[model samples]
Structures are given as C-alpha cells and as structure tokens.
Target: MKNYWSRWMFVPALIFLFSSCGPSAHIEKDKSVDFSRYKTFAWVDKDGEGRKDRNNRNDITESNIRTAVNKQLQKAGFEETKRRPDILLSYDLLVERSTVQNNDPVYSQPFTRAFYSPYYRRYFFVNYPSQFIGYDRSERSIKEGTVTISMIDARSGKTVWQGWATDEVSSRNLTSKEIDAVVRSIFKKADLAKR
Candidate 1:
C-alpha cells in the first residue's frame, strides 16, 4: 500500500519535470498552396545576393541549422537543386533573454496550537484564524532561442509555409542532434508530405 501511494505521488512530479523541458513548435502554411507540388527546393541567400552568402554572424550555428533543415526536408522527399526549384527555403535564428514571472497564490490555513495561561498555569488550545496571504511572486530570466524556417514560392517570391520553433537555450550553442530534433519536430507537425 505504501509503495503504491509513493509511486502515485512521484508520477505527477515526473510528468511536470519532463513537460517543462520538451521543445514546442508552431507551424503556419498557406492552405491555398498545394505543398505536394513542391518537389525541389533551394536555399535563399540571407542577404538576397545572387551568389550564396555566408554572412550569418554565427557560422557554426547557421551551418548546424542548415544541415538539420536539409536532412528534414530530404526526409520529406524534397530534393535540393541549384536550378530554379519549386520553392525557396530560408531560415532565421534569433536568441534573446526575457524575464518570466510566476505569481503563486499564498493561502493561510487554520490551525490549533497548545498554549499555557501564566495565571492559571494550565494548558489550553487556541484556534489560529485562517487569512488570505498575498501572492508569492518570483522572477526568473531565461535565454530563449527561436528558429524560423520559411518556404517561399520561387517564382512569386511569396511565403507559402513557415515554421517557428522556440525553446529555452540550454548552452551557448545547440548541438547538431539538438538542431536536427527541433527541425524534425517542426516538420513533423507541418505534415509536409501529406497531399
């Protein structure tokens, strides 16, 4: 019985810990555009230059993001082409620090305490009244990172699909696998391959 009760109590804590760490993504796409028609894609220059530009301030981070996006797109049956492709894929990264505040309601509970009357020299119980305690507010600053991937129609130069994945930045930079997972999650939610 004790073991079962302990297990039940631990489940919620475990769930909360895991839920707080997972990455989330939001995807938006033009419903009118048929994604199935897009069979090939090419990377768009960050500065809209004729030639491929490596002007991204963080070369390593950009490389990792590009590699991960390429892998996910290829997995979805999109081929990278140099010639005029069906869609132009572009990605951007943003990192910023923000303060998050949590306001927890504080409540006071009624309680009974044993007291001794000095004159009577006897022990007596007194009821402590319950009252509303204000709120316990705490602020924490966190570094947040966002990766936005957009697909533009090569001919029209209009965005057809976009995905944004944001999460707390754990380190100075994210590893290749981490980037891959984030991109994959975004793509998975988009369901790009489905007709």
Candidate 2:
C-alpha cells in the first residue's frame, strides 16, 4: 500500500514539476464577440497603395482572399451583412516582404550542412541545432511576408477588429492556395479556443 501511494505521488509530482517548468499563459474572454452590431461590409484602404490602392482597384484583384476570410467568419457563425453592412468593410493591407535565407541545413549534405558543431570538437562536445542554420557554408533563401489586417465600423467609422499573418511568399507571387491556407490559419488562431 505504501509503495503504491509513493509511486502515484511520484508520477503526479514529476508531471507538475515538468509542466510548471515551461511558460504560464492564460487569456479568458469574459464573453464572445457579438456580431449582431455589425451588418454592412466594405473594404477599407486607409493607406491605399499597391498594398490596397483605391485608385487602382484592379491592382488588388484577389477577391478570393476576401472570400476565404468571409467564409472563416461565417463558419464561426457570424452573419455577413448583405445590403448596408453593419460593419464598413475595408482591406488594410500591410505586406512585409523580405528575402530570408533558410539556414535549415536539410538542403546541405551531411558534412556540408551548417553544422554549428562545437569548434572544439575534442573537449567541447555539444550538439547544436546549426544543421539548418545557414552558418557560413550553405544557404537557402525564400520570400517571407507578413500581412497586417484591420476592420472598421461602417457607421462610426472607427476601427474594430484587426489581425495579421506572416507567411512565405513563393516565387509564384501569392498563390491562391498559399493565401487561403495562411488566411484560414490566421482566423483560426485569432478565434479558436485552443483545445
């Protein structure tokens, strides 16, 4: 009986200690968002440029991007405003694009990869994660991008909901599949009560 109790206590104690060793994060919503107040949807381009130029409405021709976001909201049970949407819709596009060299050594050969192995191979024996770190020898580059999002109240003309996503833009510009995946993930993260 004593041994059983000790074993049980040992397991839970290790679990508590291991769990507590990590970070502490919590966010409780007093209540969910009420979509009732919003009705109309109109795209906004506060700083209209290539990101979202009202003058060149044709420049931002990815209606599917908007559609994908709308679908996510609808799936979450928010009704879209048909006529005069309660919410004034606007696309606030803030695209941060950069060429990021993926130092991920997966592309490098076994010995050639950026093996950030301790320079003192004899005494300092430590396995570092430099295999993928571009280090000095091998390098890979890709376009990394971030899109900041925003929402405005149609009536009051005030900003309401806002969110953004950072993603990899391939050589093919912004593929529909890429946009859809990233946008959907953004909505899910900004909303889901993670299970």
Candidate 3:
C-alpha cells in the first residue's frame, strides 16, 4: 500500500519532466500538393556539400540525422532512388547558443505528525501543510538545435513539404538518440501516406 501510494504521488512530477523535454515540431506544406504522388525521394546532394554552409556541421551528426530520416521515410513507404526521384529531400541543422529562464517554485517539505484520534482510539499520521515560499528565478545559457527537412518537387524545383524541430541540446552536436528524436518528431508531423 505504501509503495503504491508513493508511486502515484510522483506521477504529476514525472509527467511534467517528460513533457518539458520533448522537442517542438512544426510542419508547412503546399496545400494543393498531393503527397500521395511522391513515391520516391533522392537527396539534393548525396555528398555533404549541402551542409557546408552551416558553421556547426558535424559529419557524424549529419549522418545520424540522415539515417533517422531515411528510416522514417521508408517506414512511410517512400523509396530512395538516385536516378530521378519524384521528390528531392534536403535537411539542415543548426545549433545556436540561447538563454533559458528558470522560474521554479519553492516550497517547504511536508512533514508528517502523529495525532491522537479520539474516535478511532488510536494515533494516525497527519500531513502538515507545505507552504509555498516563492520562486527561484535564474538564467542559464544552453545550446539549442533546430533541424529542418524539406521535400521539393523534382521537376518544378519547388518545396512541397517542410518540417522542423527545435529542442534544447547538450552541445553543438547532437547525440544519436537526440538526432533520432528530432527526426522522429519532425516526421510525426509530416503528411506522408503509406503506399
């Protein structure tokens, strides 16, 4: 009983912690474009020249991002073709320094006190009121990463679908897990239908 109660008590805190760590994803696409027609995709640059313009480019990070994106696209029933794909895929990643403000609530820890229960003829544990002291305000600099993926119409040379994801990163380069998360988040918002 005690373990069950304690487990349930931390549910809200666990939820908040996880919810705050997820990346923010957004997508934009041509409303008139038919996503179902895009059956094959080829990278705009098979080499790494596409990312040469980015100052924070890391070869390993780029590879991880591409692999993750490839997995998601293939899962969506899109094939990778080099000859001439229906859509051209391109991706860009940027990690910039940013400041985050923290305003955490301060509260006194609750204590349990024994109280006499005349009706029950026994003693029971009563929780004392925990007062909110105030909020601790602080600021810290952190690295934020934004990954954008664009799918363009090969013949028209116009972007048909684009999605981006932003999240707090530990450093200038993203870990494998983080790259996967970013790609998964962006693809989750993509309007790809399985063929």
Candidate 4:
C-alpha cells in the first residue's frame, strides 16, 4: 500500500518539476540593418492616435508592459526620445485557448495468490491474472499567452527586429515582476548588442 502511494505521488511531482521550468523566447531580426547606428527610440504611437486601433489592451496592462520594455532597453544603452528617433518601438499581446486530450493506458488484472498443498508439497496458482488493457481518457483545456515586441527603422518604416515570448497562462493574472522576466527572456535571445 505504501509503495502504491509513493508511485502515485511521484507522477505529479515529475509533471510539476518539468512545467515550472518556464518558456523560451523566440527572436528574429533583419541581418542587413546596422543596429549600431540606432541609439534612440520612440514609441510607435507617440501621439497615442493609433492606440485604440492597434492595441485594445487596458491602460494598466499597457503601462506595465511599456515600463518593463523601457527598463530593458535603457539597460541596453538605448534612449527614448519624442523627436526624430532612430527606431520606433511597438508591442502586442495575444491570448489563445486550446484543448489538450491525454489518453493514458489504464491496466487492470485479477489478483493472484499461490497456495501450497500439504500432501504434494507443491504450489498452485489461484485467480490467474488477465491481459492488460486501456480503459480511461483525460482531457483538459489550456490557455497560452504571448507578447511580441517589434523595432522598426524610422526612416524606412520597416520592421528591423522582432522578439516574442510565450508561456502557459495560469488562472491568476501575471504580476509585474513576472512580465518583466518574460520581456527579459525575449531580449536575451534577441542579443541586440551583437547586432
């Protein structure tokens, strides 16, 4: 009974351990652009005219994202400006839901026991077991969220760099610190300094 309980406990621990490792970021950039030439950036919607159309995000959420991005960019030596900036910065948030079905094989067998005959001194099997077969299915719904940041050349008006991070969404909303961590992971893969 103890061994069965231990095995049952171990399965969930393994799933939790793997799931908590977090998600990876994906980044892409235009190789032809000269990143060193750009030192300043301005928000794509500097005038706030396109905010309603492009980003339907709430004010608080948008503010948090912008603050996080600003900190990360400033750390990378890029300054924010209102006029004649070298590059334009913009971001988008997305949430998607999907169903995941897991078909696990459930096995069952009849209990067996060996009994010894005193006269013959031989053991005989009772209640022989049967072949194993799958009998159960499980299904779950999962939500995934993603944040994408883009950098465009002010003069050419073309996207020069893009980075995105995706992770499984939880029931509770993400904290500011968690959002910052996700942005940091995306930029780590971007490696803008190398450009």
Q: What is each predicted model's overall lDDT from 0 to 1?
A: 0.82, 0.54, 0.86, 0.82
Against the hidden reference, what TM-scores do the models get? 0.70, 0.51, 0.74, 0.69
Candidate 4, residues 1-195, lDDT tens digits: the string is 999898799888899896566668998889898899999998876455666663356677778889999888888889999989999999888767777788887767778899999999999989966766965788899877788999999999999999999877763355676677778888777776655
> Per model, how many backbone clashes are there?
0, 17, 0, 0
Candidate 2, residues 1-195: lDDT per residue as tens digits? 998898788888898886444212222322444545554465543464354543233344357567777777667655565566666555433344455444433434343224344665544334434345344444555665444445666676766666666666664345667667667666665663221
**Candidates 1 and 3, the one with greater lDDT:** 3
lDDT of 3 by residue, 118-163 (tens): 9999999988989999999999999999999998999999998889
- When 1 and 4 are scored with TM-score, the better candidate is 1
Report the CA-based lDDT of candidate 2 relative to the real structure: 0.54
TM-score comparison, 2 vs 3, better candidate = 3
Give the Cα error of residue 172 in candidate 4, in Å: 9.9
* Candidate order, lDDT descending: 3, 1, 4, 2
How many clashing pairs does model 2 include? 17
Q: After superposition, how far is residue 5 of candidate 1 from its true place, in Å?
A: 17
Better of 3 and 4 by TM-score: 3
Which segments of model 1 are wrong by more than 4 Å?
Answer: 1-21, 47-56, 107-134
lDDT of 4 at 150: 94
- As a TM-score, model 4 comes out at 0.69
As a TM-score, model 1 comes out at: 0.70
**Candidate 3 wrongly placed segments (more than 4 Å):** 1-21, 46-56, 107-130
